[model samples]
Target: MSLNEWFERGISKEEYIDSLQKHRDNFLHIYENFSVPTSDSLSNKENIRTIVLAEEWCGHCMLNIPILLRLTEQANIPIRFLPRDENLELMDQYTVDGKRYIPIVIFIDQEGNEVAKWGPMAPEVKELVEKLKVNVPTKDSPDYEGAFRQYVKEIVDVFRHDAAYWNYVYEDMIKSLP
Candidate 1:
């Protein structure tokens, strides 16, 4: 019924690691062999600190935490974790329409301003990836670097969308982290 229960029933750490490894291998292969752009040239130049409001017992939180961890690794971003129920006052700072969604990801700029917020939507993989690709230039464009940044941003965005992809990304991130 809970997120931890779902994880226990669906995937063990070993299984999660194995799947993540496959994704990492594939990502690396594509990254190295393909001419896909890198995220070094985006317009949003501010460094962000992410505040993840979630509960370990939440299914969505269980699924998205791993992906968030992975994106943090790949992007070298810093994140602070907080339990949604336990941190009610703090969680109020990042609610959408006054509702506290588990795994709500808040992006704060260097100035501590809330730049963007996303969550409460659980899109499938194809939709998630497509959403990422939006507003990003094509690889054929001269501004490939900028495009790549958008790609990276999209990857992070996808993690916020749902639990399955989040779980996949999170498993890989956990293995990769020190």
Candidate 2:
């Protein structure tokens, strides 16, 4: 379904936040940093409409989509969500490295042409995740899940403490208009 249909289905931002479950704390920290101004002159500057493909249960989705929502809401740019799992056709077109990734956002111009897309994670955060994924032990290891959870916690701590870093992500995403 399109984002309009999703919104009509009551898959709202509040519901998505609640569905974060154990990941809500980390998302809350990020959401706090995604500051929206009282007036955003940037709204409709490029006349862009956005569709966010995401899933609430996704760790990466919980982190980035809230930021996307904040920026779009501030800009007064209409935005919608389509669950990545249920929308394979749309997700396949904007895959991260040829694989479906949650929170892949598609931007459309007023004339119905595609403008740009962004997703999965912020750039620096993606770099951190790549490194952590390699270093963290797999299920074959006896204490695999524990080590992995620790790594995940470390990343979330970075989000909580590193405001400047995440701000860059917000800026870069907004500045991507062309």
Candidate 3:
């Protein structure tokens, strides 16, 4: 089946929005006061299909999907969703170092050839992740678990209140699309 059919078979759009609205207050802040684009180049967006592969419970996915839902809705873009876990065969193709990552969006033309793909995060935030990764204890370390949890918490906290940070992300996302 096509990806759109797969998406419709999986989750209703309303359910997706409801899930987004229920995100933790901190993560929810990423969408607050986001200025939805009032105009977009129609010719550039025409006949493009966007598929968002994500997990409902992921904090990053929670922070990003609402903004996508709003902006794409306004732009009249035909976007769909697929759960990463449910599409392992397809999902495996997108892994980084053999580990699956959520919120990876695949963009395609009308004939289904890929145009461009963008996800994970914008450049600046990715730099932060790299910096944070360096401080995490290795698996062989006795303090691995605590250190890892602390790192995860720090990333989540960054996503919570970083409005200027998210602006760069949103702008990059819009620019990356076909």
Candidate 4:
């Protein structure tokens, strides 16, 4: 199917948020409090729509999707949510290193041609995640699973409450727009 057809199949923001189980509160928290910075660059955008490839269970998606929602809402752009697992046909096109990533937001023109895309993490956020991963033990180590879970928890905790990280995501997303 074409990108436009895939986008048409996506759920609305209300449906997507309502269906969220794991990060519904986190999503709400961000949406309620975060504000998009004024951007002349975003002011004149016309005939643009955004499609988000995400899964509710993904921590990265949990962190990024809400911000995107707030951004698109403020910018007056139409946005749709396409669950990553159910829509791998489209996700497959946006893979990194042959692996899929969640919370990839694509901006498409009226013709459904991609203008730009943002995903997975802001550069600063990615650096922080890499730093956090440095201490996780290998699979052979007995503490590996526990350590990894702890790392995930730590990242989510930061992602949920840190305005700096949220700003990083917002700024990067703004840079990604047409």
Candidate 5:
């Protein structure tokens, strides 16, 4: 199926958010609080639309999806949400280093041609996450699983409370939008 077809099959913003099994509060917080910076660049682009590949339980999605929602809402850009797991066929097209990543936002024009894309995490946020990951135990260690789970929790906490990270996402996303 075409990107447009996949987008059509995706859920509405409300439906996606309402159906989230985790990170609902974090999603709502970002959705309610993020302020889209004024962008003269997007002002005249009426045909732009976004297809978000995301999952409810993804920490990155919990942080970035709502910001995307607010940004698109303010910019008057229509957006759709596709579950990454169910949409792997499409998601695979946006992989990095052969790994599928969630919260990938594809910007398309009225003709269904992709203009730009942004995803996963902003560079600064990626750096921060990497720094956090340095503390995790090696995979061969007996405590590796527990340490990794703790690392995941810490990452989520950062995503939840860091406005700087949110701003980084907005900056990166805006730079990629046509």
Candidate 6:
């Protein structure tokens, strides 16, 4: 499925926007002094670029895309998106050692050197969702801190242990993005 289809399946535009708002609010509440990193800062005088390679059908993408969008918005960073299948040549240019994975986010520095790459594991998404569901805020319950920490840990693990896939996907993702 495509990104549009994925968005449609997971939530409506209105819902997405609402979730973004909620996410922003929650983020701000905890990080009032936090500032989104600028592209310049991300690159540290190098030209830093970000690319997102994703398919709409991916549940992991569904969960993480919004967070990325929100982060970029807050940080005032520019990002580009490319469909995994549509940009085959570009994919070849940056694919993670030939493996194809959806929803890869790549960070590239000015020298076109890869800085970092991250995405989800096929097994981890369900676990993440289950954990998130348990921590989602409600009138009777609110514990975003724990949930956020867990979420970060899951993401960190993806990059730490899954280096090859992460690197390949990140390379492809960065190449395809604007």
lDDT of each: 0.51, 0.71, 0.71, 0.87, 0.86, 0.49
Q: Pick the winner on TM-score between candidates 1 and 2.
A: 2
Using TM-score as the measure, name the better of candidate 3 and candidate 4.
Answer: 4
Q: Mind giving the per-residue lDDT tens digits that candidate 4 earns over 45-93?
A: 7588998999888889888888888888777899888988888889999
Candidate 3 on 69-105: residue-level lDDT in tens?
Answer: 6666666777777778888776777786678877887
Q: How many pairs of residues collide in each model?
A: 2, 0, 0, 0, 0, 2
Give every collision pair in model 4: none
Better of 4 and 6 by lDDT: 4
| Candidate 2 wrong stretches, greater than 4 Å | 1-10, 36-41
lDDT per residue for candidate 5 within 1-178, as digits (tens), equals 8777877888889899888888888788888888887653457667888899998889899989888887888788888889889888999999988999778999888878899999889999899888988989899999899989999889888888889899999889888976
Deviation of model 3 at 57, angstroms: 2.8
* TM-score for all models, in order of appearance: 0.45, 0.80, 0.80, 0.94, 0.94, 0.41
Q: For candidate 3, report its TM-score.
A: 0.80
10 residues in a row with least lDDT, candidate 2: 1-10
lDDT for 103 in candidate 4 is 80
Clash pairs for candidate 2: none
- C-alpha-based local distance difference test score of model 2: 0.71
Q: What value does the lDDT take at residue 106 in candidate 4?
A: 89
lDDT of 6: 0.49
Taking the tens digit of each residue's C-alpha lDDT, what string does model 6 give over 1-178? Answer: 3333322233332343444432343333323332333442323323445566666544445445555565555445445666667755545555655777666766665555556665643344535456656655644546766766666556545433443433343333333334
Ranking by lDDT: 4, 5, 2, 3, 1, 6
Residue 104 miss distance in model 5 (angstroms): 0.7
lDDT, candidate 4, equals 0.87
